[model samples]
Target: MKLILKNIGLLKQAEITLYPLCVIAGENDNGKSTVGKIVFCIIKAINRYKEDLQESKEYQVNEILQEIYFKFRRALPTDDGQIPDVLRQLRAITTGPANLPEQLATVREALEQLEQSGTETRSTRQDIMDALEQIQLITDQPEDTRQSIENAFNKVFASEFDASLLLQGAKTGTIRLYDGDFLLIHLEVNAASGATLKGDVDPINIKDVTFIDSPLILNHHDLLIRSQSMLDVDRKPGRSLGRSYTTLHTKDLFDKLKEPALPNDLFATRNKALLGNIQKLIAGEISYDKSSRDFVFTKNAKSISIKNTASGIKVFGLLQILLANEVISKNTMLILDEPENHLHPKWQLHLARILVELIKEGIYVLVSSHSPYMIEALKRYADRADLKDTSRFYLAENRTIEDRNRLGEIFDVLTEPFETFRQMDAEDLRDE
Candidate 1:
């Protein structure tokens, strides 16, 4: 998949053609993280929509209309206490053109009855009249009304609604994903207001994408310790408290784990090998104890809780469990933000190798990193004959796709700290 972005955070414009292994490298605050988050948000939104559709098992149109109606009914004035009847009439009237005339007749009869009773105030009569006129307008332009309703519902359910809150200072942006000559999906957002302006394409059965931000660590803990009762807590009051990208990613991971695991045969050979390599680096096997509701690490005839493990181990441990449970597969788009966060230099190299192996297994990895060692290891491993064409690298500072030669330039810049140290040593010797 190829992702194109415009006016997103510090990236004025960036078009990245994602291969199985893709890297976005730059100094801090140069939009590398922003790109990762945007991709994550888009993929997360599409996945959420798919999950909702699958669970409801209803026609998309009907599902959207029902939600809109719920909101529309709630917003109606309660002066008449007849909104429920009004909604019923509206639904009945919009069923077909044949019903329009009959519905209009009913409305006329009701107006007559109201006039005859003379018990209601003029305000009540005016409200009914206005509602009737609106209904007539909607009935007269049925196609337009349906299109308008779909657009309204799409806006309400768009991923940007929550992404805007998670990605602070986001203003306006456009995301376009394409496969070869075909444009798969195009989504536009006004991030400040959490509104999606153009998203007409139905994203059902599209690519499976997962985003990993900093909160993966916290989410890992939640997965180990969270219970059904904890998730059942009333989150209405906390809705306004705002969630970090990590929090949302963690919640999604938690939900995915609730599903039954796929068969072992469904696991690809390369994925298993890659995961095995990571396990070797961690020096232990990470497994969730279903009966105990805890993540246990067993190594050298000793068992320890995952919470007592090191941060780097915890990070890799999360990946281990996700893959073992088959929540991640070859079809998954794995976006990682700073995967090197808590790792030593050697472990960073290990992670780079694991990532390359994931790409070898047909998983698409889009990673944002500031670590030189990780990027260098990735370039080295990706250059292998079988993996050469499966990888692409970019320097986010220039906001352009880069080849190995350009990556060398980035390497030079990243290594300037060594030159500074050398210069300081020379000055100290001269003063001596």
Candidate 2:
């Protein structure tokens, strides 16, 4: 898989080829996470394209249902507060698998009957009739997947989203993804018109993309899961419902945790083995306690709350949960942003080895980090595991570099602190 970004945020132009295990080490705010975000957005939009079209139609249908229901309510007796039969039927249609066209016909006939009954004013009847027009408009043509993906990309980026953040006074920008020769996503941004998408989506190529921004997400599982459920049921057409920051990644992981594990086939067996490795690393297994609706670490025949568990333990713990649940599959691409965040340098190295080994199991891994230990450890394990060629590295500073030999360059940039310390030591020795 390859990704090309032109004039995206601080990254003026970057053509990143995603290998089995890809790492990009960079300073903060260089849009290192941008590649992962774009990958996530494209995968989601393609996979959910049908659902988006259907859901948009459903939303449009619900608006008419709601309008008709309110019209009946205003005409009904207020003292009893009883819902009219028409309102009941409308509510039922929305609550179940609706035959939307048939339902629309029924609603239109009902409206006509109400008009003849002399209960509604002509203007009110006209209002009801006007809303019904949207039914035809919505059902007439398909909702464009390009628009859906563009909207999703915007939401995924949130506060950091700016399609036209060009550099060198460039007027246009683009983000494109390709699987070999097939184009999966193509997003073009005109400096004036914001953003537009034009490309073919290779829907079946990528099964899924999971971004683990932080293991700390486990702490906010309850809130994220609840919100995700709401979004699934009735998400409004705009971004006004969500916060300034993107919640898709966090909410997605939390929501997936509650889903049933995949079938226990050969694929699942491989996942189980990886899960075992993670459990061994932490010297414990992380399991979800259904009764308490929480995650717990079990070791020495005792289970303890993740809150009480060390943060470093939670890093591997997150991987343990994902692998156990079969969320990280062969076709799945796992994106980790600074996973070395709370881990010790020793664990960081160990985690790197685990990640490299994970790629060997047929999963794609993209890691963005500032840890030299983690990057070096990954390179070592990737070599020992005979996956050195499939392991790619990048240095994201002013421009993103795409080359494996540049791994040392990435380490040098990350290890500048050691150089600074060495210089400080020399200065102290001279003073002595």
Index of the highest-lDDT prediction: 2
List the global CA lDDT of all models.
0.60, 0.72
C-alpha TM-scores of all predictions: 0.65, 0.81
Prediction 2 TM-score vs. true:
0.81
**Candidate no. 1 TM-score:** 0.65
Model 1 scores worst on lDDT over the 10 consecutive residues at 228-237
Which whole-number lDDT from 0 to 100 does residue 403 have in model 1? Answer: 34
Expressed as tens digits, the lDDT of each residue in 1-432 for candidate 1 is: 677777665666778776778788877767787666666655655555433333222222233333434433443445466644555654554343334456566556545544555554566666666665655544454243324333433432342333342234556667677777577667565644543535454453336666666523433555334432111222122333333332444455555543343232223443677577766878776666555555667678576876777778867876776777666777677888888887888888877877777776667788888789889888887886378777777787754333343576667767889999999999999999
The runs of at least 3 residues in candidate 1 whose Cα sits more than 4 Å from the true structure, single-residue gaps closed, are: 53-171, 191-193, 197-199, 202-206, 214-246, 256-272, 398-405
